[model samples]
Target: MSRLTDLIAQAKERDLELGRELEREFKVLSARRSFGLNFERHRPENVELPGRPLRKGDKVRVLPPRGSTTKGDQRLWKVLRIESENGMRLARLELIGVADPESASVAVDDLVVVAEFRDYIYPGLVSTGKVERGGDKPFHTVINGENFYALEALTYTHRGRIDAIYIDPPYNSGASDWKYNNNYVGEDDLYRHSKWLAFMERRLLVARQLLKPSGALIVTIDEHEVRRLGLLLEQTLEGFTIQQVTIVINPKGVTQGYLSRVEEYAFFCFGPECKIYPGDDDLLTSKDSTTSDDGYSRPRWKGLLRSGDEAERKDREQMFYPIWINPKTKRILKAGKYLPLGEEPDFNVKDEEGNVAVWPVRKDLTLGRWGIGVYTFNDLVKKGYVSLGAYDKKRKSWGLSYLSEQLRKEIDEGTLVVLGRDPNTGVADVVYEGAATRKVRTVWHRTSHDAGAYGTDLVGKLLGNGRAFPFPKSLYAVEDALRIIIRGKPDAVVLDFFSGSGTTAHAVMRLNRQDGGRRQSICVTNNEVRSSEQYALKAENLRPGDEEWERHGICEYITKPRIAAAITGRTPDDQVIDGDYKFTDTFPIADGFEENAEFFTLTYETPVSVSHNRAFARIAPLLWMRAGSKGRRIETLPDEGWEVVDTYGLLVNLDKSAAFCQAVGSNGTIGIVYIVTDDDRRFQSVVRHLPDAVEPVRLYESYLNNFRFSMGR
Candidate 1:
């Protein structure tokens, strides 16, 4: 050990960089086993763009011929020229950055254009189309692109503004559902675990910056990666509080060796200001448990008379008060102030309606204190939070009850229904239509959460194809998960990067319908074609970017159509959808939600294009999102000097600053002012003169600097 230390010290003195490397290697060699996460962090993941055609001077990669091998060459080739020979199209290619470069000729169809993760690409969006319900409701956006790049772009527009994020990333259970470095990782793959961690870590780091201070992030996974994912979240989201909940998605269970797996896990990471809200059900009862006679679960009221330790009136003088009740109706009218310790009680006091006074007394006839103080009881009486209990034969007086804080909140949020006045109490007779709410439990078992019956089957019905996509989340499950954190925020902004089949967006729409909320969801997914579909398309000589092949991509094939069907209450074939949404709220599917949605494909642009103001058409939607995504978007440069719309304003000509400011001030609803100019001094001067409420942004320059800083352009 002494000799080893001496050698290490000498190596460090000789060369600091090499010494650190040697020390690291020594630690690995001497350890019993490596711990924590370890992987090739810099290994670039490559994706092929079949939509981009091969052209001379464009970089390309040679793809293996069909039925050859699963492994393909990772080497990148540069296209030198394109030529036709013997009725065949061929391209000359050169290996880039080689000292003695080698050149070869390959058929155009044999190569695919690649986007390497190591290089930075300017990102933009192109609107494909939209579904409008004709209202001022914010549009739920679905972007088709690699999630990492989409998240990077969102950081500029939605940073620190999202209220909640729910994602269902691939489980990496040695299935074909997930990919690493553009290849599916089989069960036998040696580094699959490490690759999964690295892939998740990169995206999560960027996602962490998109949350508001009060926002929460919910990630659902199966047993295959739950433990590893939990550890990764701990390291990545250091200060946030993390909790895990187990949900039974398959009650029958799938057999695995000794035990049958029936449940998955959802990890909830709550920010400092985040909290779990109440659900319709107590979330604790067994699926088969019986409810009340009305098919509802009602709150069990507690007596208002103090009992047990410190129950005497002398214990708390302030709690010793008289509750006036109408003798005829048994209705609680008001609460009288507390009696002094030396004062004698008056049981004969009556209100103008011949109401009698009631004192808190024990069964033994000893004086007791009220459960709540006089002021609290008085306020609760007005809000119907107080209740009257049945007559007690032993005490010869009617008892009183009150609601807990959790139950009161349920009444306020409309989760509990109020059925006029109770004949006995005259207070609002509120009852929960399902199970009474309680603190969210760690274990959840509901028939609606079953993946097969609700998830796979429901999605099949919507898409009209049983296998359009696999393993979509149960609609009710997603809604319940989101409701726990965002129940109070009616106009929240929710995002899901791994938006499979657009489940998160559909769930958000359902939530909005349930409560009349205007919450908007931003879903991002890739347009990668399924492996089986790719093989079939390739057999027909169809490439990825071809119209027919592109239509089969996940976004176009499943997500877009599913969302449209859900919003329009009709299937892609123009027939009304069958069935109804169950659990929490039930309504016919044909009565589609009154909502608006838009689809966009992520596009790449040159920084030069954005800086020269040539890409305003592409960048306009993003600005609308940044300005709260309300009203109509300014899609083109105004022919007039300036333009002011519902939520934002734009000044195309600096000569119209005064008019623009006047219009902005007069409108009073605009919150963002985009001034198009390259001059910093002039922009600052105008900003100071504008209204104090609006935020000023320098166009082109501000847009260029954002990506340049984040993407290192």
Candidate 2:
């Protein structure tokens, strides 16, 4: 265990029943980051509001309110007033526009206040996923392979508590690859790009609320949408700086090369101090590690090291200066000392004329004599520093490389550089080859590292499906990038929202296994759409059992089952790969969108009630299920997007009550419930929250707003 891990060990191992859930939330809050959140943190910072109270050193979102309007959502002010009634002020207000202003006070309802703190809490092991409402154990579900809209559905369910996220959304393409709410975004549709942007924007907006102050976000993108992605990021994410990484994936060039395509950009937009698990600059990079032919590591420098002054003297006080030395190695002294580097002998001098008797004296010190400082060569060797092993009269250049190698060998053989050194690594470039050279420059390797084949094989096995999704990410490539970011930080939460074939999840697990680190991953995939267009090439007609199996295949069990296998360390039933993961298919609650504690308390509709389908699981409570159960369920995540089922008011968001409304039927039963109200049309369908109807509810309004505005009707 590392020092950081050791410090956090008790916290990680702590049991979270309820208060503990709130407690561990700080850690989660510290961990989770969203894309726009990073940019917001980095961009010109402004004093803003967080959903909660501000603490010192907290990163707050600032909104300048000098020329603000009365028709905007002043949510922070309202929440503060509600908080202030209890005689406490959490938000610090600033009135920048009111011409040398003091706190601008207009309406108690609309005074824009700046809140500084942000934190997210959850109930259990359940990350961002679709949650069910009633009873226990999932009864039935909507099996989506992609589940693209599930997170949107969940925003209402698990509202107000997401910290960080990474998404790889579809770039608009017509090859049956990308989808918008289950519909393909073919190239022919002019609004395809717009639709995709809207879909992403809604998710980003809601994602903002889910982040803590110190959180960040990462989104993956390709060339197709890079142009619009910039604008979309600007509009949706608000205050953040965009960072783009170009990964050279395919060096072989495209099939039809207008230009042999070799690289694709991974555009990254983030907040200040946002970091993925990459190696920090403070740590030495592998490029700095170099070894030489002499089996010794040495610093690589450019230009040349010309010899300094070479005057010799009995009392050589001028030449002695302090030099930095390695202290770690204990010297294996053999009754010897270091030698001084040999210098060029002036052919005219008596020392070179083989006259030990006529050695010249210093002109200034020795009273204007015929030569420079005078001393024998043996006098300089006793200091145990400089080396003069061999000096050729032919070549005046010193063997610098040879000397560096000799020093390295000496250090390796217990020759201390200066004072005896403690084991430490700092203040040097890395030696790449054999740890013998100098600092490595950029542009060394052309082809990037990718494990696409391994990912393809993994996907093929667990789900027992081949070519389920096209062009899934390479497992190794993802790890390579993550390894760059997540250096030395063992326990990290890796998230990938656009999980086409579970490559990100697989890489995290593989890296964890490789390094013996306890890293975890959260991969989200929408139950994608599959066309039933018959294959004209198939020979046989469908059989009786085959028809039923085909019908059953529509369920979203394939992808989730495979990912679960990877997590729990169970062999995927597929034959292509033998590796395992601990996971299960989390079916969404298909029934009961109501708020009825009564069903559990008083009423017994059936032996198994509708509420069983809707109990959203949490992450902390689901550790037991993570022990490789094939069909196990996880615990509920708090304030997540989920539906409440029952008779009373259907709580759309566990946090935002205004997002919900109720309507009662004339027959005294549930007509319908409005879980989604951010949209206008949803109001008509909402059932009144009368105690009689007992209607349950969850909504997709926040998600729908992105698309609703585009409707022609």
Using TM-score as the measure, the top candidate is 1
**Candidate 1 lDDT:** 0.82
CA lDDT scores, all candidates in order? 0.82, 0.37
lDDT of 2 by residue, 142-162 (tens): 123223233433343333332
Give stretches of model 2 more than 4 Å off.
1-148, 153-164, 181-183, 255-257, 280-448, 451-468, 483-492, 514-519, 532-558, 564-571, 574-713
TM-score of 1: 0.74
Q: Which residue ranges in model 1 land beyond 4 Å of their true spot? A: 1-39, 53-58, 63-73, 79-93, 96-100, 104-111, 286-437, 465-467, 710-713
Residues 1-713, model 1: lDDT tens digits? 12344466678877889888888887776564566644445365666666566766677788766544344666778998999999999999999745478899999988887776666666778899899982999999999988888887898789889999999999988877778767787777777787788789888888888998799999999989899999899888878999999999999999998999999999999987786677656464423222466645566666799889999999999999888887677778888889999998876677676888888889898888988888889998987778777766666466898876666776777656676776666587667644444456788888889888888888888878454678899988899899998888899999999998998999999989888999999999998888766777776766656788788889999999999989988888888889988866788988888999999988766777787778888888888989987789999999997899999999989988999989998888889989999999989988987989999999878777777654311
Worst 10 residues of 1 by lDDT: 282-291
- Candidate 2 has an lDDT of 0.37
Cα deviation at 613, candidate 2, in Å, is 10
Model 1 error, position 510 (Å): 1.2
